[model samples]
Every structure is written in structure tokens, then in C-alpha cells.
Target: MQHAKLKRSLTVFPIVLFGLAYMAPTTVFSTYGVVAQITKGMVPAAYIIALMGMLFTAYSYGQMVKAYPVAGSAYTYTQKAFNSHIGFVVGWVILLDYLFLPMINGLLVSIYLNAYFPSVPFSIWLFAFLALITIVNVIGVKIAANVNVLLIACQFLIIIIFAFLSIKGLLHGMGSGTLFMSSPFVNGDIPISLVLAGSSILCLSFLGFDSVTTFSEETINPKKNIPKAIFLVALIGGGLFVLISYLSHLVYPNFQSFKDPDSAALEIAVYIGGNLFQSVFLAGYITGGLASGLASHASVSRLLYAMGRDGVLPKNIFGYIHPKFRTPTYNIILVSIFTLSALFVDLVTASSFINFGALVAFTFVNLSVISHYFIREKQRDGINTIKYLVLPLIGAGFTIWLWTNLDSKALFLGLGWLAIGMIMLLSITKMFRKQPPELSIDHAEVNEMQA
Candidate 1:
């Protein structure tokens, strides 16, 4: 029996919304205190640097999605642009995000729930969170997108509230006593190197912008809208991160003084809006976590299906789409199971693991652009030179810079995962004697569907 394909009902609006949801725009608060400390009270500055770097990579992603409008994200781009062996490794490395990200969301939410309800078991909260996203994804990505719309809207509403209260506090001479302050960007004697390090960690904030490409198959007009959505998602999401971090900085200038860096946002909420607003703020933070889990859960399932359909993984299980739902049923279930490991891991370690793969994927995607456009297609004309080579080269440079700045532990873990993937590649291709299995991505057929 033939497997049902992913349903094509998504427009660019929902696609961008899904990316924002995955990125969790409200996450600025969740990560604010940690990044604030890392950058020496320069979280906003770090975010600006991260946004610039991510925009370069986002440009490369837009270019790639235009060329290959399909389900696989960095995996498909790297495979088609270069050799299958290298692509398999890139896909495997990026697969770390697919495997661990959902769990990170789960772990984050469970912690919040456990805090709110001291009597409940963490496992219960985690299981319920996993079940909700899994069932939503299983029903359909359209439903997931719709759910994201609501969850993401809540996140934005909370942000607006926070911004309002922050502005009020600034007017009344609270923390910084001024809305416009340069202290968030520059402080006494803090090295630029620390802000760069903070930006490396903050790169995780822009994680899902490229993910919209994974929905190319489901999106209407994959080539046209997918590229547009990618740029829009990255720009909008990054802007939000920078803006929110700046506001939070202005509201509470002393980043180093939080009782618990992990729960610093809560303290800020209490400072600005008191306990009632604090409760509402916590609810919104949890909403953001749920939104990220739902979006990431849907994204990784499709990525797994892409790898599975390519026969790099067990095709029978991972590639099999649900007949009626037109979703990657098995892959969705598999992701939920892997997310169970969140119960065992800490948030910091889990977050570090994702950034390693994300930065590497960014680096390779930029390289893929050069390989596909500059070298393979010989698009060496005047403007094509800049479009194909220079821009992506800058993108690669930015990612490599971020890669080197990755936490030492994450670097070690990522390399270990890559080594294991290479070993698996050797086994799959009989010691590199043959090309690994590849997907038959039919752009022509997709265009026909578009027409």
C-alpha cells in the first residue's frame, strides 16, 4: 500500500506562525537571566549580535528552500548539494535537535508545573505535555498550526503586558528610571568576547526559523512562499528576541542579583506587576513552552520521515504516513518516546546539545548554497556571484564563529554523536563502497500541485 503524503493546506502565514511558535518568542524571559549574566548584563547586545548572524544564515536558508522545496530541511539541502555520505552525516548530526528538542520543552514545562503544583509528580506533567502535542500532531499539522496560533498569541499578549508594565516602571523611576538606556548594550570594562559567548548561547533562541523549510511540502507554493516565510520568520522572531531582552534589561538592570537565575523572570514579573501579574506571567511562560513543544514535535517527525523515506533509517516505520491523517504517525510516536528521556536530563545540558547541531546545520547549509549555486550550476555571473557565493560565505563564517564558541561540553558531546553517525554510515554503505539511500524529491510534481 502506498503511504499518504503530507497534506498541503498551510499558507505562509501559518507557516511563519509555526516557526515563531517553535522559536517560542516569549523565551526571552525564560533565558533572560542566564544570558544576562553571561553577557555581563548585556543580553540585549548579545541578542543583536545573534540576530545579525542568524539573518545571514536565514538568507542562505531562503536561497536553498527556493531550489529544493521539500520536507527535509538542512538534510535535503546538504544531500542534494553535495555527496550523500556527507549529507547523511549532516542529517544525523542535525537529528540530535530532532531527538532532544522536544524533550527540552518537556523538561522545561515539567519544571514549571512542578513549581506551581508542589504535590504533583514531574512525570505526570511531562507525560501529559507529551501526550497533548503528540495527539495534536497525529491529528494533523493544520491542527497543530491552529493550536500554535492560540498559544503563540498568548505569548505575545503576555509580552505586551510585560512591556507595558516595564514602561510604567521606567516612567516612575523604578530600576533604570529611563526607557532609553545604553547600559544594556555597554557596561564598564565588560569585554566584547563575553557578549559574543552570550550570542552563541542565544543562537538557540532563533532555532526554529529554518524549520519552516521542513514544512515546504505542506506549504502552498513551496518555492515562492517557503523562501519568503523563512526570511520573515527569522527576521520577526529575532526582532522579538532583541526587543524583549532590551525591555527586560531596562525593567530590571541588575542581572546578577537574581536569587535564582533559572527563575529570574518570575522575580522580574513580581517587581514590575506584583504577584497577580506574576501568576499570569508564569502561565504565559508555560504557554510558550507548550507552543515550542508542539511545533518542534511536529517538525522533528517530518524530518525523521524525510530521513526514513530516504532509507537511511528504517523506512517501514519512520517513512510510513498515516493514511487518513496524512501525518508521520510512526515518527510522531517515536519522537514522543525519545522525549521521555527529558525526565532524566537537566535543562542546561539538553539545551546545550541542541545548539551544537543547530550551529553545525547552519554552517553546512551555507556551504550547501555555495556547492549548489556557485560550483555545481556555474552561476558565476556578476550578481549571481554575490548571491551564490559571498553571502553564503559570510553566513558560514558567522556559524563557524558561533560553533567555536559553543560550550566545551556541548562540543565534546556533538563530536561524539558525529563520530557515532559516521560509524553508522560506514555500516549502512558497506564501508563507503556505495552511496547511501536517497529520497526521490520531485520538484516538478510539487510544481504541478502548486499550479
Candidate 2:
């Protein structure tokens, strides 16, 4: 049986752009800034090392996505390559991860807005941002892609400007060379352990690379462009992050770091560009948020809609496509409700707790890629698979190492989400089992047909 391929509305550039813009520079910048402060300038080296480690895993994903271009991303790949239980878990975790992404963006927007407006309620900013993104997303995917491209341009422009200014400043004796003089092998005040823990926060900024794979079904050339886009997203995102971390230390080397990851970028903004610069940054920040929020909503809505068409989730709620718009209307509305609620709650308590979920999901994705490709390779008959096996294992190991090194708070949050997802999955499975066998098979067949 053959399934019709999805039309490619996304290009490599938009995929890369969305990855970079999804959580914005602040997500990684703020989260990892503490690590930099702790390392007392060694943060750049850490980023470089982390990037190197991630590349091997990135290749595995690139290859996997090419072989299996599906809407569910890792969920689909892992399930097909492995087992249904593993696939179910992957889908559950990734869905949870996706659900929390908008909240993180919303929280960051609220925080940044407060710095500028000071008097406005965080909830107001949060909802306003959400509403804006929702409207933009409802228009069409092309507009969202264009907005992502523009947002990416704005962010890259800022990063380039900052990198050059910082490098020039350093060369002219205006900034710190302390990290350059320091040895990577030696322990610093931030403590190697703390730095590793801090790296977990910063590492998420490095994620979204594989998010391109989620849209593989909609890509024009999934095999070539999806792989290329995955690699490009990781390479570009990693390089820019490393550059920014290095330049930030050189421009304003700080011994004491800000405790809150949420405020990290604001500190850098104040230090690097000052009040005037902050205004410009405010524009970039808001733009990035809108871009990311819209992209996430669109992508995840499609994911839900796909699942709905599968009967894994309630089909009625998500399967309603707008005839005029040809869009997943119910899924969009459902996502909007949850997103707005998260925004309101996050505004009150500043709960960007979703980052933890995202990182954990990322770690699993890397691990799953490694498991399916690396571990499974040697078991196959007479296939020359040394590169496949080693690279993937290393990637998996790196993911585990990073996951283990996460701060207790991060671990707690991640585990909590996972547990909740597990319970949800169990309920979902039980419900599915309770359905008549004929109906279950029929629905499953329908999903297969749609796929």
C-alpha cells in the first residue's frame, strides 16, 4: 500500500530558522549564562565541546529522518525501528515537551516585557503575545515561515553585530582574556560539576535542530533537505551559541552570575548595549517569541491532528479541519486554550518549567537515535556498521551523561512531567484496549491510510 507524500511548504532555511528562533537566544543565553559565570569564562569551551558531542548524534537523526519521513518525528522513527511500547513512550514524552514550549516562550516574553514596561502586568503581555502568534498562525503556514525567516535574520544580525563588537573590543584591550588564559583541563570556581549542570540549561538552546524532522512529511525533499536542514540547524545554532557565549565573556566578564536563567539575557543586554541597545533587543526578543510561539503552535497542532486522524487521541477534538482554511481548526483552538492558560499562570509565578521537559525530551531523542541505529546495527546480518554503531552509542552516552548531570531541580521537574505522561499513556492504552477489536483495527487502518 502506498501513501501520498506530504506537500513541502517548508524549506531548509525555514526549518533552520524555526529551530534557532523556537526558544530564541535568550532561552540558551540566559540558561547557560550562569554556567559561563560559574566557569568564569570557560563557557565558550564548554559550548564547543558540547557541540562536538552532539554532531555524532545529529548525523544519526539526519539519516533516520531521511529513511522515515513522518509527522511524529522521533515518535514515528523510534516506534518503527524499535517496538510499539518504546514508540508510545517517545510520543508521550515528545508531546509533553512540545506542550511546554509555548509556556517557556510566554514566560520569557513576560519577563522581558516587564523590564521594558515595568508597570504592565505579566499576564497581559503573555496573552497579548499568545494572541498575536495565534492569529498569525491561523492565517497560513507560509506567513509563519516568512515570519520565522525574518525573525531568524533579526537574531542572526544581532548575534553577528555583538560577536564582531566583542571581538574587536577584546583585541583592543577593552574586555577579559581570562578564559583564554585558563586551561580547559583545570577546575574553575564554578566547579566542573556545576558547569556541567549549568550546561544542561544552556544545551537546550542547542536543541530544535532535529525539530526539522517533525515537518519531514511536509517537506518537499524530505530525504535530502530534511537531513541537510537537520545538520545545518545544529551546526549553525551551535556555532552562533558558542560565538555569543565567548563574546559575552570577553565583553563583560563576570565572576558572579545571575541565579535566574530567565534574567540572564537581560543582564547581558544591559551590560553589552545598555538602555538604548535594550530597546533594540526588545524588538528582536518579541519578534523571536512571536516567531517561535507561532511555529510551535502550528507544528504541534499538525502533530495532534495527525494523531487525531489515528484514533490515538480523541479524533473529534483534533480531526476537524477547516474547509476554507484547510487548517486543523480544532487542534489549533485546543492548543490556544492550553497555551493561553500556561501564559497566565507563568506570568503570575514565572514558571518557565517547560525547559526541563524540553531538555529531557531532547536527551531521549538523542538516546533513541543511538539505540535504534547503533545498538541495533551489530545485531543485523553481515552489515558493515562500525560508524553507525559507534557514533550513535557516543551520542546516546552523551545524552545520558548530560541527563544525569542535570541539576536536581531540573531532574525533579523532568521526572514529574515524565510520570504524568506515563500515567496519561497508560490511560490512553487502556481506553484503546477497551474498544472493540474491529473498531480498533479499523481506526488503526485509517491512521495507516492517512499516513
Candidate 3:
């Protein structure tokens, strides 16, 4: 049977904007204190290290997207580059990243909202935002992309205003001497181990860029645009993260000064701009969370659709696309159901579980580049050895190192999730007697023709 294909309507600009929205530029504030505590006020250094590490993986993603422009992101790339079983397992691991993201974003939205409206229950805001994000995604990716443009614009505006306020406050309150302190970048006294440890958490801010790969099928000239979008998202998002952390560090140099580490950014906002700007800051922050939730919900639905269409999951439901909206309606609703868990889960626990799956998928994407170029193709197709081999090796190594440094809770939860995926894989492949199911490029071409 033929299936409807996603509309190839997104351009490089919209996709990059969507990626930025998914990364949520204002997130540095939400987790600022935690990273500050870990790095001993060297948050910018942690972001710089994390950005460098992610760039290697981003290059791998760009190469793979050129080779296989499909909807599954890492899952499709890995499966095509390697084998069906490994791809199936990677798809499961990616589920941990894509599926739980909306939940984490929703929890963040609720946390920030609850802080402002102390009387209202958190569950109300959680479900409300989830429902809104679900509806927007179900309508269409184009609409979601458009919404992201506006939301991201607001976020950037708020960030610019905040930066100005922060600099002004710093000069007036702490003098010009404090403006260029090395404490935010490094303190010769702090151990390298602490900076690396902080990077493990800061890496979370960079998670959404790879989600751009999932939009390959929907993006115009995806072979060129997708890779560009991936690199731009990583570089732009990373630069913003480092800058914001540096400015924030200048505003509050003492890492141990926050009464509540999680909400320290909010306190800093009030200190810089007073109560009025604090309200504006909260509005912009909440908008960032909304943008993140919307993009994540859309990504997970597309991923499930890709998996379902490949027969890795039940195709009848997940593989169904809306004729009117040109979207995976059922999968969108399914992600909404998963997001309701945010009502019960706190931000820390929900946030901790995501890093493992992301790191695993990132490591494999690097390996996928190596497997495709070096192992199978054997002809780097005129591509340099550095692009195909050395870079990916470094990327894999860096991600592996970060994976090993995951929080103890994250490590346990990630392993448990992987164990469950293994069991499911056994059932699907019939205990290794049969190959795991997949959709071929030829089959996808036929479906596109039919559509």
C-alpha cells in the first residue's frame, strides 16, 4: 500500500529557526545555577567545551543527512548505514530522546508558570500547554514553523534586552573591572574534572539541533539545507549559550549565593530590571518553553511515523498521516499522552533521563558516518579522511566520555530503558532468527510517487 509523504515545504531559514526554538535560547537561565555550582562560576567554559564536542557530531549529522535525506533522523541514517538490528535498537534509544523531550519541556513550562502564579496548581498549566502544543503540531509543520519564527523572535528580543540590562547593571553596580573577569571562563584553581562534569549537563542545551534532521523529508533541497541548518543551529545556539552564561556570571559571580539554584536566573532578572522586567522575562521564558514543547512534539510524531512506516512499530496507527493537514495525527496525539507524564514528574528527574539517549544516538551517528564512508562505501566518494574518519572518531569519543559521566540516576534510568528496548527488539526479530523490519529507499520513492 502506498502512503502519503510529508510536504517538502521547509527552507533552510525556517528549519534553522525551528531548531533554535527547539533548543530554546532562554534555557541557560533555567539551569544556570546548577551549572554555575558545578563549574564554580565557569559556566561559559563548560558551554565552550560542550559546543566543541557537539560540533564534531553535528558534522557527522550533516554528512549523513546528505547521504540519506529521510524523516527518521539518526534512526534512518544508522539503519541504512549499518544493519537492521542496530537501527532498530537505535530507533528505540532515539525514542528515549524524542518521546521524553516534550515531557521535559512541559515540566519546565509548569515550573516557571507555578513560580509566577503560586495559587494555581501546576497540573493545570502542564496539561493546558500540552494540549495547545499538540493541536499546533497536528495542524501542520508549516504552521508550527511559522509559530516558531514569532516565538523565537520574542525570545531573542528578550535575550537582547536582558543582555543590555545585565551589562548596564554590571557597570553601575560592580564597576567596569567586573565586566571582564576571568572567573566566568576559568579560575586557575578549579579542577578540569569540575568543568567536564558541568559540560555533561550543559550539553542538554544543544540537544534539539539534531532534531532538524527529522525534518529532512519536509525540507526543500534537504541535501543542502538540512546540513546547513544542523551546523548553524549548533554554532548559533552554542554561541548564545556561552554569551548568556558569561553575562549571568558577571551579574552574580558567587556560585554559592543562590538560595535556590534552579531559579537563580529568575532572581537575577529581578535584580537587573526590577519587578516589571521580571514579568517580561517570565513571559519570554515561558514562550521559549512553549516553542520547545511544540517542536519536540512534532519531532517525536515524525519519528514514530518513520518507524511505523518501516514496520518497526504498528504501521496502521503510527504510520497514518492526515490527508488534510499532511501530518501524523495519531502519532501527535500519542506524544501528547506521553507528555501528560510531566504532570507527575519533576524537572530534575525528567531532565536527567534525556541525556543518555541523546549521547548514545550521537555516538552512533558518528559511527554511522564511519560505517557508511569507510566500511561499506570503501570509496570516501572524494571526501577527505578527516571528514569520514578522524572527526567522527573524536565525536564518538567525546560523546562516550560524556555518557560515562552522566548523573548516577540518569545512568540507572538509561540502562533500564535500554534493557526494555532489548527485550522488545528480541520479540520483533524473533530472537535473532529474522531480520528486523525496515523500509528501503526504493520503497520510499514509490510512496512519494503515489502521494
lDDT of 1 by residue, 1-451 (tens): 9999988889989888777876777777766777788888899888888888888888998889888776656767898899889987887887787678789889878876776675998899999999899998898745344665787788889989988998999899998888898877777788988888888888878877876777888887888888888889988988888888888888898888987676678889999999899899888888778766776787778767777787777889989999998888998998999999887766556666888898898899999999999999999999999999999999999889877887777789899999999998999899999887753322233222212
Q: Candidate 2 lDDT, tens digit per residue, 1-451?
A: 9988657788888777666664365445545445665556577666765676567667777767755666545555666666666666655665665666666677677777876786998778877877776776665545434655676778867766666656666776765743363443245544666556555555656656666666777777788888788777778778777767766766676636554444566666766667776777778877777666676677677767777776766888877788877778777777877776554443212222444544444555565555666577544334425445555667767766666766665467567767875676667668546421111111122233222
**Ordering by TM-score:** 1, 3, 2
Model 3, position 151, has a per-residue lDDT of 79
Between which residue pairs do clashes occur in model 1? none
Which regions of candidate 2 deviate over 4 angstroms? 1-32, 37-42, 66-72, 135-145, 177-186, 212-229, 255-261, 316-337, 340-385, 407-410, 424-451
Top candidate (lDDT):
1
Q: Estimate TM-scores for all models.
A: 0.83, 0.76, 0.83
lDDT over C-alpha atoms for residue 446 of model 3: 23
Measure candidate 2: CA RMSD: 5.7
Per-residue alpha-carbon lDDT of candidate 3 for residues 101-158, written as tens digits (9 for 90 to 100): 8888888778778767779888988878987998888776444456667877888898
Report model 1's TM-score to 2 decimal places. Answer: 0.83
